[model samples]
Target: MSDNWVVQNLQDILNRWNSTLSDIWTLITMSPENFQGGAIWRIVLNIHGALQAIGYSLLVLFFLVGVVKTCGTFVEMKRPEQVFRIFIRFAIAKGVITYGMELMLALLSIVQGVISTIMNSAGFGTPQDTVLPQEIIDAVEDCGFVESIPLWAITMIGGLLVTVLCFIMIFSVYGRFFRLYMYTAIAPIPLSSFAGSPTQSVGISFLKSYAAVCLEGAIIVLACVIFSVFASSPPTVNPDAAAATMVWNYIAELAFNMLILVGTVKMADRVVKEMMGL
Candidate 1:
């Protein structure tokens, strides 16, 4: 039964492709000029414009945050706990920003899906329109696939966003990991003004805790990456397959970021232990 479903789905896709080809052929053979301006093109252009805007926005935001954190680090040298607190604040802020960006992406995906469905329904008249053994072809053609955005445009935009987001998310994870390490590395350094204060040992203990937290983050990222790689390869033919793949990839990336946090904690612990000879 499952095999039959797969076969049916494949046929549907083939039919859609055939219809698309036929449309192109007709356009080329008929006027050739008719392909220049169309609603499909406009839809595609709009999507591209929106994505470019989003990307730029994220890049600027990341940079601004970096500048602020750097300034805080330099200015807060007299108060060690203040520096650590700022680090924690930055981590939380970045996480929130990332989550919000993801939510926006999700909304965009839904919009794209709806647009595609509408286009598919309207019947743009492509070549593959006729090849799908009639029954399947009719079912697909009648189902509203034509009302959606052109396949080429959709594929291009979706691919671009996925590529960009994946890289940015991975970098974000790495950044967090590095920050965690920094905090841990400096853990044993006393925040107190007095050189011979008894409270100096507190710094060592803090370092150990910080390292442990980083180690936990490292483990999480490793697990996420490993599982995601296995789940999505050898691509399936489902309509939702691309989205699913992106979802899993994002998950893995998030995990990777967590792992970095863990690594920071572990490093801090090791550094403190060595200092204390424990």
Candidate 2:
């Protein structure tokens, strides 16, 4: 709201940058079950419920296949010890199918705990706001008509880039939530693979991948915490420089920092997978 349009333009872009960071912070802490006031989660739960039958049917097939492959002869399978072992495997598989979603949620909750711990240890309640330096603003205010032209162009370009980066960052965070929902909705089909000894690797890999997905929140939170520390110290403005140079330096550096944070968040899944050896 500055009388100086250049100042106003810069302020608007900075505001958007701060708002997007705040939104990303909020999302990393929220659970899938609580997302969108639970509307999306309701649909996900219904789909998961419908898939339970399919998962249960697949579970029996895997268990029988496992028994056939693991036993060399029909007589070997008839032994009391073999029957008990097979019965145990079937019970475990059924239990896994029955509670697979809950298991995934529990894993997610653990990751949430990790995210909370990282934020607490880092002493950041939220990402710090990156603001336009006052020196730049005062300098911009002092620019005469001729000088203000370039200042206007600089602000316009910087503002557009900032605005674009803000949306890109927030959209990346939203995409993380969508991925979580997709993994949850189709969890049972992969989870049923646990019924077979030979095929259990499929279930193990599925669970590990889900854990990695949940761990993405932790990695993203850490990235935000690191960025918050960086934002606490804004880009230094040279008071002696031209108003345009100062603004350009500030905007370029500020935009670069924002890009760093956004890039880390966008690559959070890959980072977690690498760390977890997924």
TM-score winner:
2
Per-residue lDDT, model 1, residue 100, is 32
Considering summed lDDT, which 10 consecutive residues are worst modelled in model 2?
228-237
Q: For candidate 2, report its TM-score.
A: 0.96
Report the C-alpha lDDT of model 1 over 1-278, residue by residue, as the tens digit: 12333225444433443343333233322211122444443454344444444534543454355445455565655577865654564454434333433433343344334434433454322212222233322323333344322332333443444345444444444443344434422322222101112332453445344444333333333333333343323322334334323323433443343345334433543554464455
- lDDT at position 61, candidate 2: 92
**TM-score, every prediction:** 0.27, 0.96
| Tens-place lDDT digits, model 2, residues 1-278 | 57988898888888888888788889999988788999999999999999999999999899989998999899997799988988898888889889988888898888899999998899888888877777887899999999999988988999888888878878878888998898899988888888889889999998888888888888888888888777778678889999989989888888787789888988988898888788
The local distance difference test score of model 2 is 0.87
lDDT of 1: 0.38
Please list the residue runs of candidate 2 whose C-alpha ends up more than 4 Å from where it truly belongs after superposition. Answer: none
